[model samples]
Target: MKKHSKIIIFILVLSYLLSGTAFSADIPDDSNVEIVSDEVSAERYARCYDERNYEREFAPGQVFITLKSTTPIVEDYGVLFSEVDVDYVKVISEKFIVIHLVEKTRDSVIDAIDELKDSEYVKFAEPNYRVYSGEAVVPNDEDYNLMNTWHLQITEADEAWNYSTGSSDVTVGVIDSGVSPVADLVANIDYERGINFLDETEPPIDIYNHGTPVAGIIGAVGNNGIGISGVCWNATIVPLKIYDTTNREYYVTGIVEGLIAATAMNLDIVNISYSSLTGDGMLEAIQNYNGLVVVSAGNNNTDLNYNTFYPAALSDECDNMIVVGGSTPYDYRYDLTEQGSNYGDCEVHLFAPGAWIYTTCADGSYRFMTGTSFAAPMVTGAAALVLSYHPDYTTAQVKEAILNSVDQVNALTDLCITGGRLNVKNALLYTPISCGDLNYDWRISNVDVIALARYLENVLELTEHQLSMADMNGDSVVDNTDLDLLAMMVV
Candidate 1:
């Protein structure tokens, strides 16, 4: 999913009554968003297909409503359907339902949803939004070889595998078109749990080809004399297809449904290799998710500091989210005139090798692809590897481990918050030290106290990672409170 190519609803939240808990969300209504596209590059990146309008929109006449636990669905809530002029009611989950109003116009749907949301029986109501994958297609010319995969070598995933090759217990949900049963990927997928949210009756298959490489990048089998190795040599990939066959794109409602499915399926991480404008529903859903949600920084080549992009841009509010941008083999951001990686010192989290990436195609073959879409899975695989080694680690620990240990590069200094490329080994072996531990040692002592005092007084300089460690109370600052905490710990 390049820049505006693919739009993904926040697939982190969408759970209703999993383990008998409350419900929350992410979704869209086309009228609420403006699909920003790089007109010059939109055609340039449309390699596999003809150029088409990639404007974002939602499925018409569809309204997603969450029923309060007390409101049973036995009689369609009695008068609620008739009051809102609902044409039909479809069950999305135990507590979620899709209501189709008789009038299919945008105004009618929004107006009807507004009424439904005010009802005490309804917890929330939102429009069903749509998204698409904007990928840059290239010919199947490159002969992919596992050992020669530079993405693996550069990220040091090859070395990380030496310690742990990922775990079967950890599951990664790929929310995209879908993932085909390719040779390198078949053995790593959990077929029973995979589903097509766009059309629940059908199996989730990669008919559009965008998700295959993303999944392959995360967990393609290694040492099998196969095409390419994923970040994790061993892991489970759950195909959660949100593509709308009717429109040849993704429905925000479908992606939100996919997120719920992921939560119910107990997935540890979800990879959304796409971008779109933020939606209220998607934002709330991602915030409620308990696991890590990795997203692409989009391929618009715009600075996210000024522009707004969904899921990725919501990283500040969602702790579990890790937004990624694209980098190149030359150790520089893949910034092109019309299309490239979206960069921001605030919104975007880090960079990954997304250009000229060779991975699996939807047709069970291999090809070279580009976009922030491919960059996300590298981090997904790294997160899976960390979990495979330390299954007990929480999302915060996992995120900190990855963010605090990037391979700092000169070229990435100002592009993103963490101006460095991913280092799989560093992340896999990372164990975040205590906040007061100035030295690498786990203990806080007089030596640490001196370092902190000097740094606070401007007599010394601390790396970004150390500065985080010194902020004892997690208030995003190092002041008197932190000093007190450090002193108490040292004593």
Candidate 2:
């Protein structure tokens, strides 16, 4: 195995050295990357895609309102709506209430909010934000997409779908080798506003076929009989064709451009399934973007604590970014199938199944890929589903929902900070966070164990969510056994 690795590395180095394109040892930016071609393949016409963020949609005549704490919760908003001369929709959650006015205009929502602001019943109000895909439900395309999609079962995404299939309101940008409008993926993509940084004359179609699978994993129109459903069944998939050199150049310009465009679009989430060294252009663009960004920790088996892969390394600087490493179907941090997934305490944040993973193909079929590239989209999809449940959640909260809910495993114990693999159902549970986070800090550690001990002794108070989290054994009671489990986790 070592000889094979040395031979492979030697070959790669020789090829690059001969081509005069060997990556610099000084930094990992793609300035010196060698180009292959800019021509795009005519695999098929277009299919899936929607420009949601481009033409931001709002629910007409509907306003989302949160009542003051002092006011009583109105189960029946009939009287209140009658008084305000508006119709009541349904209670979204304790965070927000939806009400539809007779007048159907963006102005009506503003006017309604203005009128209700004075009412003691109203604490704050805004338009019921809508876009291409906001509704959530379980999908029927599970059988078709699940043929080789064991990663979903590994992370419990199939169960999480019961909570939210995904929302069209959310837009996730796939800035990789571009995407193809394949039959399975065509139904969920938004083609109206795609950006091809490599070529302007042609659409951002897949010539290398990397982003198609990533996009399919995130939002491939659930229940459309598209063969596979994405993590976000209804969310819009915007193809941000920044770099089509997944197999060739490890460039940074296209990635930088994609980040800029995503920031301008105010995209909800983005998936960058590549790895490069940290540089100014990448850091500046990442820091500037307010939305959540999920990036792949390179497929190399090196520890990122010392090497520091770009966007994955940037996770320390940007709380909104999630650095995903590849795991196996059995949740091993290193997949022997290819170069093992990268890891680090400070860089690679978490692991998802990436070994021999089956997903949508560029030619509108399904294929298997093994790398952090494929794994990153699983995290991106999980993040999208969390946002679909609560669009109001901050990037920090959404990030915690995914990170804190990881399933602790021995293989990942020393590989990454989380020391666990993705658990989609656990992540979707509660408001989100902490395998045993009794203190409700969105993290599980000694502090939580201490809090749990105190709670057992009747010395601390915990919220309903915290109590649920404290039930480490799922026996419906927070006992010393649960406390013991929490303490073991901290250690």
Could you say which candidate leads in lDDT? 1
Tens-place lDDT per residue, model 2, 223-314, is 77547677777788889887645455547988999999999988888899988765557888987888899999998889988886777777
- Please provide TM-scores, in order, for all candidate models, with all chains considered together: 0.62, 0.62
Name the regions of candidate 1 deviating beyond 4 angstroms. 1-148, 434-491
Query: How much lDDT does each candidate structure score?
Result: 0.74, 0.71
User: Model 1: what TM-score?
Assistant: 0.62
TM-score (C-alpha, index-matched) for candidate 2 = 0.62
Residue 278 accuracy (lDDT) in model 2: 54
Per-residue lDDT of candidate 1, residues 1-491 (tens digit): 12121111111111211222000112222243222222232222222121111111457788878889988667564366666887878877769888887888777766786577668778877777653232211112233333236567667676676667888889999999989999988999887899988777888889898999999999988767757778887898999999887889775666678778887877899999878875546776776678899999999989999998876777766768898999876567887677999999887888988876778998988876778999999999999999888787777667867887888878898888777889898887776545565553335666666666666667667766567877876668887556656665544
Error of 1 at 340 (Å): 0.6
Off by over 4 Å in 2: 1-147, 244-250, 432-491
RMSD of each: 24.1, 17.7
